[model samples]
Target: MYEYIHGKVIEYNYQINMKKTFQFSLCGQCYNVLVKLNSKAKKKKTTRSPSPSISIAASEDRINKNEMSSEEDNKSEFVLAYKLFVKTADGISLPAKWFQESISTVDKFLLSVYNKIHLMTKDNTIMPSYYFMIFKTQKETGASTQLVDEQDFIKFKSEYTKLAARKSNIGIYVTILQPSITS
Candidate 1:
């Protein structure tokens, strides 16, 4: 016997010592109904037309062509942008701003950030190289990574993408690197 549950067919059978018969009683009534355990439905065998097989070299060529086309499409379609929240070491939050991938290098990004800070504080004595930025992950125990001018913005963009995927607030912490005194 078979039963349907949630649009799926399941076998229904209960046996005790290889015996299939079971007793059932209803309130003030006794009735008997016959059920066929074996169904008369038959499944039809499907026949499909034979398909021509391609040579291994032909298949490999097709795959390589597809991969090349996809690579070109990705290069043309790729656009990287960021909405950065800047905060100081003293916990003061600066206005958030948008940056495009066209900024290219971390040095350029730091310069732009320095310009923003300069506009607010009106301090021109400090250079962009004096301040370095740290990106902290979205988790409470997440480690902070420092961004350096030698690296490209793609690294920062990738880190941002990872945190953004978690749907949490992301910000960059900026701190001044004090000059070390020597004897």
Candidate 2:
């Protein structure tokens, strides 16, 4: 099962060697709800048309790896990011541009989340509560970014949120606790 985490602004769970880390809490209610939602999404996906990989694989088989190995290399560029899964009246969907880690300030981060909610609803009427789930993600393809000029660096301000097909690998970063002490 996928674990969901929430971001904290005030303090971290532990500190060592001048670095601080905040541990995410596992809420039973949230975990169960997400699991059910995930299962429904999986069911929907299975009922859809065949995946794009089928055609891509067929094309790849015809070409020699040595000659045309990089037909879609640019599509695989990666950026470390966070995935914000928001639940609203509409459904479960991600907020725009919330995946970028460069949202270093708390105010902007909150604003972006609210902005996405507003855009999704398109109504001035405020919702009573907001449900948020954050996972450390790697790409911001769904994020809307401003068009960059020809002269500017590609990753300027780390707002490259339009890249597609981000693969989230948060499990790779999790580690065990309860360190053993040497006498």
Error of 1 at 161 (Å): 1.6
**lDDT tens readout by residue for model 1, 20-117:** 44555532111111121112112111333243233334544654576587445434423335455644435556676655554544556667667765
Clashes of 2: 1
Consecutive 10-residue window with the lowest summed lDDT within model 2: 171-180
lDDT of the candidates, in the order given: 0.49, 0.38
- Per model, state how many residue pairs clash: 0, 1
Once fitted onto the true fold, the runs of candidate 1 whose alpha carbons sit more than 4 angstroms away are 1-104, 138-142, 150-152, 178-183
Best by lDDT: 1
lDDT of 2: 0.38
Q: Tell me the TM-score of each prediction against the true structure.
A: 0.40, 0.25
Superposed Cα RMSD, model 2: 22.4
